[model samples]
Target: MNIAQSYEKPRWSADLCSCGDTGTCCITCLLPCITFGQIAEVVDEGGSSCVLHGCIYGALMVIQCHCLYSCLYRGKLRAKYRLPSEPCNDYCIHCCCEPCALCQEHAELKNRGLDPSKGWIGPPNAPPPMPPSMIK
Candidate 1:
């Protein structure tokens, strides 16, 4: 499948997403899920523009930018709930595996054309990608 064309919502405008939307990141061995609701909450709470999904997008951009072996690190859920000034190095911003349960549930709900503005039940994943040069 064309990773770029698979999801309805891409990462270009992920920062502006509202709620119930889904996005992918390259931080783990599986696809990590992200939702607009989570984005909004992080933004509203004065958190950094970077979230788990954002980090995935970041890593992909790094690969596109550097054209080398740059790994995607897993983000820290515990630090996310903390103040924006706190250390979020857990998100790795380089390589990661930790997934968020609430975020994934929200994305699934949105995919089904349902609203999950309240909470989430599923977990997020972070799947690795084949290098662009390896693809025919």
Candidate 2:
């Protein structure tokens, strides 16, 4: 069988409102930039800094259409996780419901075993390291 065929189809861990993560929901609702930044940093695997991303998101929110920028990350997250383009396309989804999109992304990472609030989880396949005493 093909390697790709061996894997099951990807699905969102939680529904938009059924997220069950009230804290995240509240945070996203109140301060979307903070939530978006955390989600972006985790999604980017620390390749991008959360503060920088948050600042840019905030700036775009002030100066122009930040949804356009956020939708790009939604696309990136979907691609990275092989998630289905369900409900709607990234652009439409973000434009129509920015807070919901951010919440979903946050829940996606949390369900995938990565906590955005805590930052990147590193490579999935990386080897575990020795304890501090074992290190040189």
Candidate 3:
């Protein structure tokens, strides 16, 4: 459980290696850019979009340093959630287990009632979404 680090902070609901959901694991394994972007969008409070971030991540693959970029989001996610660095630092986790790490973050967001699939609607306490007809 505590592979590394020392601090009293909120722990992840699930272990990083668990993948939490099979579908998430599959996506992360085959297309980690998608996973990373989804996480990044949520962490960015949806200031940017999943597609935009995903494209950037995919482009980073050519240089093979996408993991570092993704790691920064992991830090942001941790700060937002007040989660501690455990089972190793984010750098090591993303570098060594990028797929699993991405899957875990996606699962974590879902568990916390923040659906990455829906993108960012607003703050957690924002009013319910308006009907599509009202959006004109």
- lDDT by residue for model 1 over 1-136, one digit each (tens)? 7976875442211121233233333222243323333433332332433254446554654555311112211123223323131123423322232333234323433453333343332333424567899999
lDDT of 1 at 91: 32
Candidate closest to the true structure, highest TM-score: 3
Assess the local accuracy of residue 35 in candidate 3 as a C-alpha lDDT between 0 and 100: 84
For 1-136, candidate 2 gives per-residue lDDT tens digits of 8998878798888776564588988988888999999988988889999999999999999976889999999999989878888798988888888898999889888887888988886765567767899988
| Model 1 misplaced regions, further than 4 Å | 1-33, 40-94, 98-136
Estimate the TM-score of every prediction: 0.22, 0.84, 0.85
Clashing pairs in 3: none
lDDT of 3 by residue, 1-136 (tens): 4645555557888788796788878888998888888888888987999999899899998999898899999999999999989788999998998888898889888888787767876666678888999998
Residue runs of model 3 more than 4 Å from their true location after superposition: 1-8, 129-136
Question: How do the candidates rank by TM-score, highest first?
Answer: 3, 2, 1
Model 2 lDDT, residue 123, Cα: 61
**How accurate locally is residue 75 in candidate 1, as Cα lDDT from 0 to 100?**
22
The model with the greater TM-score, 1 or 2, is: 2
lDDT ranking from best to worst? Answer: 2, 3, 1
- Any idea what lDDT model 2 has? 0.87
